[model samples]
Target: MKIICTKSNLAKGVSIVSKAVPSKTTMPILECILIDATTDVIKLTANDMELGIETRIEGEIIDRGIIALNAKIFSEIVRKLPDNEIVIETDMNNQTMITCEKAKFNIAAQSGEDFSYLPVIEKEDNIAVSEFTLKEVIRQTIFSIADNDTNKMMTGELFEIDENVLKVVSLDGHRISIRKIELSDSYGQRKVIVPGKTLQEISKIIGGEAEASVEISFTKNHIVFEFDQTLVVSRLIEGDYFKIDQMLSSDYETKVRINKRELLDCIDRATLLIKEGEKKPIIINIGDESMKLQIKSQIGSMDEEILITKEGKDLLIGFNPKFLIDALRVIDDEEVDLYFMNAKAPCFIKDEQQSYIYLILPVNFNAVA
Candidate 1:
């Protein structure tokens, strides 16, 4: 295959497709990126079995052919190439030549026939969301996704669409994050568990521009995301996600309204006294007019007070500093409402519209010695 394209375009194409390339795999073909230039547009694809990405770049296709090249090497070469036109050609001997202004390199290429292709997902069940809104939802909840894959469902986010409302939910064992948005057009009812890796990568591919949109389609076992001349197909985590709604409760004995920034800064400062590997709980004592925070660790202890508007009964609670900080950091509002049923029950943080809800389980008061 032979294609001539600008260095920046080629670099971007490589970067997008490279997200699916396995760093190391027993199947050597999975480490290579398939370049197809059979038509006027040049297409690049990579699949690591679980996640696959394909994108097209505008270029002049001199020879109608296809080849597979090492993703790492090709990406590095394209990235370092000068800001000039790039010419890529493959020969009969399966050797790939890459040329730029003053840099030229030749590498052995693999047969494109051996590379895996992204599975075709039917468009029967699909939803279109503005790229900006989708990105925002993912960002607000992605952090709550479990890092460890032990619980497959927790490692992914739940996309539940009912009528015109799109609800995205993610949670580790400690906390749950939910974001709700209303779509301009109703897309019917659907539910899918999307892998965090897929959403994270798609977030990077999508620009923050509010106008553009992404069309997402789902199959029985896979999900496809199409946006900006790119397509991503990923395997969905099997099984039903946890019923998180039951865990949220409006029965709170204490409700406090505080500035989001002030609470975040207080928890962040308290974390400083905590040593690495220490699971110290940040104790919060809520009163009628102010909330006090206390953290004790081997390094030291910290105490800070922030004024708050309180309703209901006064309460004292303890929580993992990181949990509160995580939820607080994502909130865009100037002030936040926090609800607590008791010292032992989970603490809830959300806005007035209930567009976002963050539930964090409090630690035992005795746990923080």
Candidate 2:
């Protein structure tokens, strides 16, 4: 394979496809990116079996062929190159050579035949989603997905596409986050659990572009995203996502409306005093027109008070300070509507506009120090 590509263009394409490269993949071919030189375009592909990404860039293709080169080496070489067009070629011995202005490199590369073919989605149920809106949904929900891989479903973010309204949900058995956006288009209805890593890749590709919509497809066991020339494929988790409404509280013993920024700042300060791995529990005492926030850990303690509008009886609740911070961040309004069934049940935080709701399980202190 022989191809001439500009360093800047190659760098961008490599960066996008590198998201699918496996760090510890036993299959050497999976760690290497497939570089193909067609008549007018150069294609780069990387995959870790379950997820794959392919991106193409305009290049001067002297010969029509393909080769698989180590993604790590190829990316590093491109980064080090000066601002100039570079030529890459694969000889009969199966070694790949890279040459720029002064620097040159040759590395043993695997034949393109050894590289696995990227999967193709034969039929796609197309839907148009605003890239900006989609990116925010990913940011809010992806962070809440469980980092543990033991349970597949828990590691994925639940996506419910019902008609024109799209709902995104995520949880780690401790807290739950749900964000809903009502669109103006007729998208029909569907639900799928997309892997967190896949969503991260898609979000990275979508920048601050004025593109009206990003195309997406939900297949049986996989989800496909087509944004311009790049395509991302991710395998869907097989299982039912947690029922969000089931974890919500029906009644509230205490309710308060507090400034979201103040509460977030309090938690940020309190988390510092809490030791790592130690439950960073922050006590919230809600009363008439005010709320007291305090945290006590082995390292130190913190306390603060924020004015609020309280309508129910006063009650104290303990929660993971960090979880509350995440839930509060999704609310764009100045104040957040808080509700708790009791000290033991999970608390619900909603936007004053009643557009988004976040639920967090309360921490039970058998004995408060």
Model 1 TM-score on a 0 to 1 scale: 0.98
Model 2 steric clash pairs: 163-188
lDDT of 1: 0.91
Alpha-carbon runs more than 4 Å astray in model 2? 210-212, 352-354
TM-score of each: 0.98, 0.95
Best by lDDT: 1
Count of residue pairs whose backbone atoms collide, per candidate:
0, 1
Candidate 2 local lDDT, 161-248, one digit each (tens): 8888888888888888888887777776788999888888888987736565777887888888877778888889888887777676
Candidate 1 lDDT, 68-126, residue by residue in tens: 99999889898888999999999998899999987999999999988898887776688
